[model samples]
Target: MTEYSAFKVELTEHVVHVQIDRPEKANAMDAAFWSEIVDIFQWIDDTDAIRAVVISGAGKHFSAGIDLALLASVASQLGQDVGRNARQLRRTILRMQASFNAVDQCRKPVLAAIHGQCIGGAIDLVAACDMRYCSSDAQFSIKEIDMGMAADVGTLQRLPRIVGDGVLRELAYTGRRVQADEALRIGLVNRVYADPEALLVEVLDIARQIAAKSPIAVAGTKAMLSYMRDHRIDDGLDYIATWNAAMLQSEDLRIAMAAHLGKQRPTFRD
Candidate 1:
């Protein structure tokens, strides 16, 4: 329901659609854009009506990366005072990183519907999502190497988990543009559509499928998966047991049992 200068938010049937609106800049992210994105995810986290989120760009490109002006401004500032500027730069970068981290931390699932160019910061954004769908015209690149720095955002950490260590290294080291087909082959994108509109339709269909599931189960599963990814197997099992001990008693389970016995749909109340 909230509108931002760089993005727009809408909710329908428990799915929140977030679209980047800066077509003129190929949806490049500035400081304000990152701040808005963080706020949008926070809004989703606070709203019970929103069960899932779909992210896409408004025009031809999903995003071209960080806004060139923003990058120039950062570089200019860094040159002004190396010591003081370095700390400020780190803080700014961490804030931007948290914007994407919020997506991963959000209890609801997030699906990225990408098209055209998805470069640099855009890669970070999609990497933070639970799922990704793209159009055939989409192109992906790490781009930080070409920009004279390493990617300080979430991509360097998350891309390896999405793909593999080798592929992540190759992409990060070379900064080459990977087309939609290549991205699909590398398992970078979940599905590829003929175009943006088709991609959006498919993504929404997927979102609806997720929305129909028990919210407690979906969120618990997401949490367990995230935890397991970083923890040892024994630790993960212990954590899952502790998690399920509390979650198994939810009304959804009772509804599910009744629905199975009666051969009817289970209606869940938020």
Candidate 2:
């Protein structure tokens, strides 16, 4: 139920639908967008009403990347001292990156539905999601190299693991556009639908399925998987072992077993 100028969040049947609402500006991330995103994701982490999340844009384009106007403002703020300016820019980059990191850290699974163009910051945004789906016509690019800068957000760090070593390097080095079919082939997206409307429908359907699961189990799974993403197998096993020691006490397992035996659907608490 949080209202934001950059995003609209809807909590329906335990799934949080979050749409970037600046379609008039191609949903470009501005200074406000950066700050607001952090708040949104932090709220996601805290809210019990949300069991899953689906994120997309409000119109034809998912996003056009960071707004040039915001970049210009940042450039203007770089005062005379090169050393001080570099330090300030580093802090700014870290702050912006945290916005996406918050999304990565949320307990609820996040699914992205993309259409039209999703470039630069848009790609970084989706890379943080648990799943990504797109329209057949959607296009993506890591455009920072073309702009004479490296992508300072989570893309370079995260996308490599999602897409793998070779593909990530090529995309980062070239700044080329990846059309929907190619994205599907390269594993950048889970699926490509016929259109944006259909993309949202299917993405939300999947989100609803995840929402129907036990929240305690779902959150533990997300937390464990994210932890395992950067840890060794033995380490992950040990971590999950320690985790479930306490988590196994949840009433969800008993409820799930009863529902299964009764041949009925179980309702999970928020």
Candidate 3:
């Protein structure tokens, strides 16, 4: 995998840990930062060694939305030629959106371990993850309103699916910060730890647990769940049935059945 200045990537067993490295900037998203995120996930997809992933920030905060300097630079560039700049801006935004989309598309489950502030684009990142855990000090907000725009990224769409339309509306419209307790109550975070260190330990433990499962089964289940989320019930049923048809023929199932019959733990290939 390529070395990234804005992020760090480490692989252990079957879990990939990705940390935002720009602590001085509160891990803010800039063009290079988003590019690196997309690259790392693509690397994960290419490498069979990684079966699950955990994401977090390096500093006190998870992220502080878009970098103010990047935003200013784009705004200044837009003044040069409105029409051309508008198209360029749209393309750039879409590229950044693809970074988060990679998390959703990854075959392995992606878990977010958030701390401090997770606002705007940070919310987009977490929303794309398969599950979220956070520190008790973590706070989240759909901060696009504060930036004078509706969130154009995945947050507006994905967050509603996670927290319901009413809750999403209240938060997005107001841009008010939601503490970890409130996030947990609304199902935004699955668990909250006392602090960042504890949060890291808990999240990594969860990741390792997930990594121990049969890779084929885990990947198939993740794919099926994602399909079900966007499809009708009948369609989802059909899809799962087709998936199972192929999956049932794998050696893992035979191994699992034999292990069950013998009252022993099943071993699976990574």
TM-scores, one per candidate: 0.97, 0.98, 0.96
Among all candidates shown, the one with the greatest lDDT: 2
Residue pairs that clash (backbone atoms under 3 angstroms), model 2 = none
Residue 22 in model 2: shift from native, Å? 0.8
For residue 249, give model 3's deviation from the true position in Å. Answer: 0.5
lDDT of 3: 0.91
User: In model 3, which range of ten residues has the least summed lDDT?
Assistant: 73-82
Model 3 lDDT tens row, 207-259 = 99888778899999999989988899999999989989999889989988899
User: Which clashing pairs does model 1 show?
Assistant: none
What TM-score quantifies how close candidate 3 is to the native fold?
0.96
Per-candidate clash tally: 0, 0, 0
